[model samples]
Each structure stands twice: as C-alpha cells, then as structure tokens.
Target: MSKPRVIYWFRTDLRLHDSPALKVALDLEPECLYPIWTWDPHYVYNARVGPNRWQYLLDCQNDLSSSISKLNPRSKLFLMREGPTTLLPKLFNSWKITHLVYEKDTDAYARQRDIEIAKLAHEAGVEVVTRVGRTLWDSDRLVEKNGGKATMTQKQTIAAGDKIGNIPRPIPAPKFLPDPGELNLDFESQKPDIDADLNAPHRSSSDKSYAKIAGPNGDFAIPTMEELGLTPATTPHRGGETIALKTLAAIIKDEKYTATFEKPNTAPTAFEPQATTLLSPHLHFGSLSCREFYWRVQDVVDNYKGKASQPPTSLTGQLLFREMYFAAHAKLGFSFEQTYGNPECKFIPWHLPSKIDPKSGLKTREYIVDSAQADEWLNRWKYGRTGFPWIDAVMRQLRQEGWIHHLARHAVACFLTRGGCYIDWERGLEVFEEWLIDHEPACNVGNWQWLSCTAFFTQFFRCYSPIAFPQKWDREGKFVRRYVPELVHYPAKYIYEPWKAPIADQKKAGCLVKGDGSEFEDGQLKLYPKPMFDFNERKDLCMKGMKKAYSVGLRGNDPKVIDGSWSALFSDGDHPLGRVEQKTRVDVDEKVGRDRKRRGQGTLDNVITKKE
Candidate 1:
C-alpha cells in the first residue's frame, strides 16, 4: 500500500523554524511530502510590483527550496502555473492528495482566495490545515468582547487579561522533520518554466558570474524573473536568505553609531536616525519568517550583552513589529484608494504620459491614463524621479537595493500623499508594493493612509515642506546627489532647491538658467521643479479639512484608529463588534520572548524597533 501524500504550500511564511503550518503538515506523516510555490501573475506582473522586488523574491524561493530539499531529500518544490485556485485543485486531485498545509493569510484577497480553495478541497475530500505563522497571534484566537476582532490599541488597555495574553502559545518546529521514506508516494506535475519564464538580466551573463553576485550561501539555484513568468525588471534588487540574515547581523554588531538609537526625533540635533533591514523581499518569498527573525535578533542580543548603553524593551519591540504588521495588511489589497479623503479620488483626475511619436503623429494607448493616478505616482516615486529629494532618495534605495530605513518610508510617503496633495497616495502605495522586497499590503496601505490622514479616526493631514525637508533630513544633500545626478554640480545649498538659485549661480552650478536672473530652465526648472503646491497653502487646507472632520469624535481604542474616531456615523463599520479577548492561554509565547529580546540588546537593531 502507498503512503498518503500531504502538500505544503509555501507563501510568505518561508523559514522552517517555528513554522506552525509546516510543523502541522509534517505531523500528518503522509507517504509523500510536497512543497510548492506559484508565480501567480496577479501578484507578479501587477503594477504594484517591479524589478528590484522580483529579484529579491527569486532569491528567497531559491533559499526556501534548498532548505526543504536538505531536510526531506525527496521533497522537491513544484513550480506550477499561475492561480492557485485553478492549479492547486488540479494538482491535488491528480495526485490523490490527502492533506493540504498552508499558513493563514490576513490580506483581504488571500482570505477570499483561501475560502474558495478551502471549499474546493472539502468537495475533493482533502483536509486543509492552516497554521498561524504570519502573525504573532492567530486571528481566530485574538478577539475582544463578544467575539470581535482584536485591535492592537485595545490589547494595551486590557493589561494581563487582554486578548494576546490569553491566547495559547503556538507550537514550535519538531526536533527532526519526518523522513521522506515514510511518505513513499510518487506523483508528478508539469514543472513551472524555471529558466525561460524568469530570464531577467542577472548581474552577470555566465552562471558562474551570476552565482558570484547572487551571494546566496546555499545549494539551491535562484530562478530568474522570466522563469517565474515575471517581467524582466529595468533594474535589479538584492534578495535571498543569506543577504537578509547578514544584513540583520551587521546592523546588530555595529558599535560606533550607538547614539542614533538613544533618542527620538524630538530635538533638532537629535533628528530621527534610521536603521534598516532589507528583509522584505525574503519575507515576501517565504525565505524568512517573522518569528524566526524575532528569535534571530534575540540571539544576537544575547551574544552582545552590555556592549551598548540602552537595553531593548517592550516599547521598542512594539514599535518595530507594529510597522511589520502595518505593512502586511496594507499591501494585501486594502487599495490605495481608501487612504484619501475621497475614496472616489482613486478614479479622479490624473495625467498619463504621451506615448505618441511627435515625428510620425502616431497616437499610442500604451501610456494611456490610468484610473489609479495614485499608482502612477508610485511608479515615479519608485524610480526616484518624483523630483522630491527626500522621497526619491529613499525610494531609489528601495528600487536599487531592495531596502530602506523604516522612518524613511513615512518621510517619503508624507512627501507624496500630503506634501503636494496634488497627487494621489495610491500611486505611492503601488510603487511601494512593486519596488519594495518586503512589500506587505497592510503595512503599505497603513503607512500611506497614516501619512495621508486617510484612514481610521485621525484625519490629521501633514504636508511636508519640501524646501525645508532637504535641509533638515539630508542636510548635506549627499543622498540627493547620489540618486539625482542632475543636481550633482549644484552646490549643497542649491542641490535641493536648484530653482531658487540666482541665474549666475545656476550657470556656474551647470543648471539651466532662464532670463531675468531667474532659474527657470526650459519653460520651468528642468533639474528641479518648483514646489508642487505652496507648502503653507496646502498645510492650511489640510488643517482646516482635518479640523472640520474630527471636531466631534470618539477616540476608539483601535490601532487602526491611532488618532481616534469621528462622531459621524458610519454605523456599519468594518469592525462593528469591536475587539474581543480570548479566555484560554498558553504558558509561554515566542512573541512575548521576541518582544523582550529587543530590550536586552540595545544594538543598532534596537534603533529600528524604537519609537520616535
């Protein structure tokens, strides 16, 4: 008799350690254990993604496959056609799959997809098992009074009796994986086009050169974007498990830059300093786990005892993980449209660049205006061509390197969503999704909405002063010069505001100068355009609009509504029943330990976890 076969579906939760879903799948003790990943077109080629992120994902998948293969020698990753609902059912039915293992997804789209898949699996008589690997607390377990959704802010008010405190600690991975011989079932499915589909230009043409630049310290082969049916990106992003871990380790070991983490951005001299990890791409590709990452940092802290002045604490850990959660939910289909005053703004007025050839008078729709202008701005922002230095530099880093500081995300988003208010936040959010390797729908949407003052209770709109921002954040304009080469020749003072310099100064600075000693080059400032909207004017407009909206409101204890709620009745609210607290509890939870570890180290890694 053949041994039963169970399949593990790899999504964002990639690492093997403390992977609840993977552990549960192994517990089934099936004849064959199959691990698979899909290059779904809806996610791969969507406007919300780009080249840098694609490269990073490729690296992550490679690492994950290598890890699984080592543990289960017969376990091979099945790369198949797009659309899990369509392909997954076919594969399972064909192979007589008995059990399906996967991590629960919180994103709206994933949740819907999972429901459909679950229904399909039930009809086919296959048991589907889902584990809570993505979040610290399982969605089913974390609730408020009357079985409602548990909000982060509400958890704070409940003290020891709050929702998370009462939930059972999730089980960790077993000491050893089940043997491949135990599940001796044999099945085959058409492999995904690993080479042709993901054939993006690697750093080198030769496989050897590609491997050298790949920097992965594992046995797996990285797939190209084309192999994954993804479009070849104009630029590449760094990816893989080794790079992510190394980057985290480096941030932890650094000793000289300790002051950056000590204080918040309250004093002018103590402006917020950013420490970053380029783990988003790996996280997206299932090369890393949030729990594993938390534990890894804990290990680093334990190794570097008392080397730094400040110790890590719950406050720092909360600030760090909050953003991670924020990114995940926002990126997964919360849609950039909801982050503005007018949800209809998603379909509002916006320009699409002309693709028509001036010489031939040939009109082209390839560059037709899109309903989502917010997404368009995101494209520009990702490429670092938005003309906003602070925003562009950070965005450029994400595009070119697949990494940037966390606070930088807020700074840049503020520049786009509120700085001008002339553009849409959706555009910015989409760009973030496309370029950022760590793209989480929740965090992306939350950050954008948070900066734009679009969602939750706080309608507070903060428009950044572009002119002053350059001086404050990038005082020397080094970051701007590195990414925006057009301003390379301009003095540090004029680098950010090339349009403000005198004509002679502009000429000397190699900038285009206009007549009458003004710096308007070629109809308008070429290198640097004038401020999109008068900073003061936009500030006044946002302030008045916010004041009117929040005049009479109840401050709901929901992290989503960080600024509280308005009195106006949207009675059928998304979270109508409020937060719920679960009664049963686990003696030990990894999340609590993970949160505690941040305080013990106080390293550069801790800086990122601390609040402003």
Candidate 2:
C-alpha cells in the first residue's frame, strides 16, 4: 500500500513547538509532508486590520517558514496566493495528497469554512484529522461539560473546566520533518474582488498580494507589507516562536512574578516595558502555545514557597478567562460578536447603532449616524483627540502600538460606551478589531461586552472616570506624557486635566489647551482640545439611562429589540436613551453619589479593580 502523502495546513497554529496537530501529522509517518498556508482574501479584504497586525502576521509566517527550512532544507511553508477554498483542491490533485491535518478552529467563520472544506476533502478522498490546542481545553468540550451552554462567568467556566478534568500537557515539536514531493501548481489562481474592500481606508498604495499564484520570486515566500499596500507599522513589538519562547523563559525565570502575579495589580500606565507579559499577540498568532504558557506558570505556582495567587486574577486565572470566552464564542457562533442576534447581550438602545440589513436581518457593518454630535465624538475618540488626557493617551497608544494594558482598555471602552459617549459598543469593537495586534474575536467581543455592561457583567453604574482612574496608577502622568506628547510640558498636577490650567499656565507650559485638537502649529506652542463634555453630568445621565435599560430588561433576542418597538420603552427626547425625567435623574444621581462616598470609591478604580 502507498504511504500517506500529507499536507499540514498552518492556520492559527504558526509555530512548530507543542502543536498537537503537528504531532498527529508526524505520527502518521507519511511518505511526504507538505507544510502550506493559503493567503485567504477573507482577512485581506473583508476584515478590518491595520498595518501593525498585518506586519505581525507576516513576521509569524516568515519565522515559521525559516524554521521549517531549518528542519528540512527541501521544504518550507508554501505560500499559495489564493483563497483556500479554490487552492486546496488543486494542490491535493496536483501533489496526489491523501491526508490533511490541522489545528481545529472554533471561530464562527473558521467553523463554517472548515465544514465546506471537510465536505470537499471527503469528496476528494483525502482523510482529515484535527486537534484542539489554541486554548487550555477544547472550547466545544467545555460547552458540552457546561450542559451545552455558553460559559458566561468565571465561576461557570471553572465549573465546566473541573468537569472536563485537567488540561492536557503540550506535546513536543518534531525534530525532523519529511521532505515534500514534487511541487506543481497547474491550475489558475482565483483572486477575490477588491472594489469594496473593507480595509481600503488603511491602504496608501495599491494591493499586489494576489498578483501571482506563487510569490513574486515564485519561491513561495511570505508577502510583505508593501505587497499588502499597508503603511509602515508603528508598533515596537515583533512576533516569532523564537522570541515567544525566550520571553516565556524569562518570565518563568522570575518565579515570584510568575507564581504570585495578579492581573488587578498590574499597572496600566507603565510603559517601555508594559506591566503584564506582552505575550498576547504571540498567543493570537500561535507563536506561543497556550498549554505551554499555562504549564510553565502552573509549575512555578506548584513549587512556590510563598502564597500563590488564585484564579480569575492569577496567571492561570487569566487563561481560564480566555477559555471562558472561547467556550462562549464556540457556543453562540457569529451571534456572539454582535448584539442583534446574541441572546447573551442586552439591548441598550445605544446611539449610532448598527444599520441592520432588512433582507439578512444582520448588521451591514455600517452604523447609522443617528446623532451628528455623537459621530463627531466617535471620530475624535478614534483618532485620540477626545481631549480627556488619560483617554486620549490610551487611544493614541493603541493606535500607534497596536496594544494597550487591560485596564487602559477598560478605561477607553467604558468612556466610549455606557460611561460617556452612549455610542454602541460595536463601534468600539470595530476600532479595536482594526488596530489591536493582539485582537482575538472571542476575547475582544467578550471584553467589550463586559465593559459596556451588555453581557458577562452588569455594573453599568460603575463607570471609569476619565480624570481619576488613570491617576491611581500614574500619579506622575508619565504615561500620558509619553503618548500625548503635545502635553509634554504640562505640570503633573494638571497633566490629566490640562484644559483646567489657566491660559497663562498653559502658555508657560509651552502648550495651549484650545480648539478641537486640529491645530498643528510648527515651531510654535501646541494646541490641545478641551474636555469634550462635562464628565459628572454625562456620568449621571449614563447611569440613569442604564437604570432605565435594566428596568426594561430586554435582551438582543427580544421581539421588541428585533423590530423598532424597543424605542418606545424610553421617553422621546434628544438624549440617546430618551429623556430620563429630570426629577428621577437628580434622585438617582444623589443616591449613587452618597453610596459611592460611603464606600470610599471616588472613581471607577474600586469598582473595576477586581475585574479581569
């Protein structure tokens, strides 16, 4: 009998280490092994990605290709410049492949695409095998353990995880890989349409990524940022399995930091070397194995002499939160990312809501400009000109670096949603999806929901203060000065509230706080925008609106929310949540103020400190 000729599809799992699927493929002892990656147009044209993330993906692909060459000189990651749906069948027939193996992806799009591919594989007479290694445990199995329901809370995730037993240990990378058979691409390439590209705004040049079936040199090399028509990446972070392993090794060597580390204690304002381990992008790219990360931290905690931090906060606890989101996403499918059809998410009647397609009954990925003022606020917020120094700094950092500390994320997200703008959380979700290098569909949607109090969390009254929240972590305002350089000369006392400084004080500081942050005077004093709105008043308004929403208690799946009848629940007015009676607003504000003062919580610090 002819030995199995295998094609190892490299998708999310970009590394060669601790890969269960790779181990499975190697265990077959195939006659020839072909490692390949098809440059899918779904991500290129359809998804919102910036230069930083695009660069990071290229870095991972190049690193993986180099590593494969090291193992076997005759083989490397073959770059097929076409969608997998059209490319894979041709490769199977051309190479006479009999087996296909890859890591299983439970993401909504991946699940659907895999189903189509699996059907094609069966028709083509190719055997398919897969394994789960992206998260601590198989997300589908976790849902099964939870009685076929989404893991909504840390407690629920923990219970489901306990039922699923211990997470499996990571397998070792293969020392040797079989050389591939003759390379042949006898079929024509099918390129995707680019007229309505979702990422057109991000490109400064024409995209040439699909110019050829093979690469420019016909060597099956990774595409470059220039090929993708992306601007230069501004982030300092780089990606690779080698770098990931080294970073993990260094963190594990700290022992105490790894064993006793807690998420809540990490300083979001610290820069240069960020407070938490900046390994998220690596995990997202599969440059680092989640299991390897978990076991390494777990071993440190197991043998530690000092008291180790526990879950929902500890390093292991962080992994569990990731598992929870993955399980939830797996259970809910595409609905998990949006509020329209998501049963778990609450209907908020937020401003600038998603424009629903009447035919499909899904978001058109375009938002209705219901309020011009709110639209302007969102644009300013996206470009880091919100005038709230703390929020602006974090937003600027995210735009330039493609990553931010978790608390910083909470501050910005809260400011954009229930806390301030009253805009839909989906808008913020789209921005993060575009800019964040570490963006995971499950984690991003989950965190946005938690921050917006739409799902997974419900403390809508607890809002992060644009002024006081960052002050707790960065009293010196060093983080603000680093990212928002226009305020470099402002005194620390007025750094977080530069607009509050007297005009003389602002001029003396070599910057003027005026205009809407559009003025750029070269060789002259700089200009920064003033606070967009009164924070206290907006907070009170948002709280009242949240209270009204909670009282209504309608979810995304509600008939009223699906139709247009939900708006009747709120009184007609200019306010996004409709006019809360003046009397009720004042009453709730006073009561909340008294409660907060009694609890010694002057800011959102106390409320969000314990959250993951």
Best by TM-score: 2
What local lDDT score does residue 210 receive in model 1, on the 0 to 100 scale?
26
User: What value of lDDT does candidate 1 attain over all alpha carbons?
Assistant: 0.50
300-369 per-residue lDDT for model 2 (tens digits): 9999999999998999898888999999999999889889878899888788777666555667555555
At residue 426, candidate 1 shows an lDDT of 57
Worst 10-residue lDDT window, candidate 1: 579-588
RMSD after Cα superposition, model 1? 14.5
The C-alpha stretches of model 2 lying farther than 4 A from their native spots are 573-612
- State, as a TM-score between 0 and 1, how close model 2 is to the true structure: 0.93
Q: How far does residue 363 in candidate 1 sit from its true spot (Å)?
A: 29
Estimate the TM-score of every prediction.
0.67, 0.93
Give lDDT tens digits, candidate 1, residues 419-448: 444344555665576567677776666666
Q: What is the overall TM-score of model 1 with all chains considered together? A: 0.67
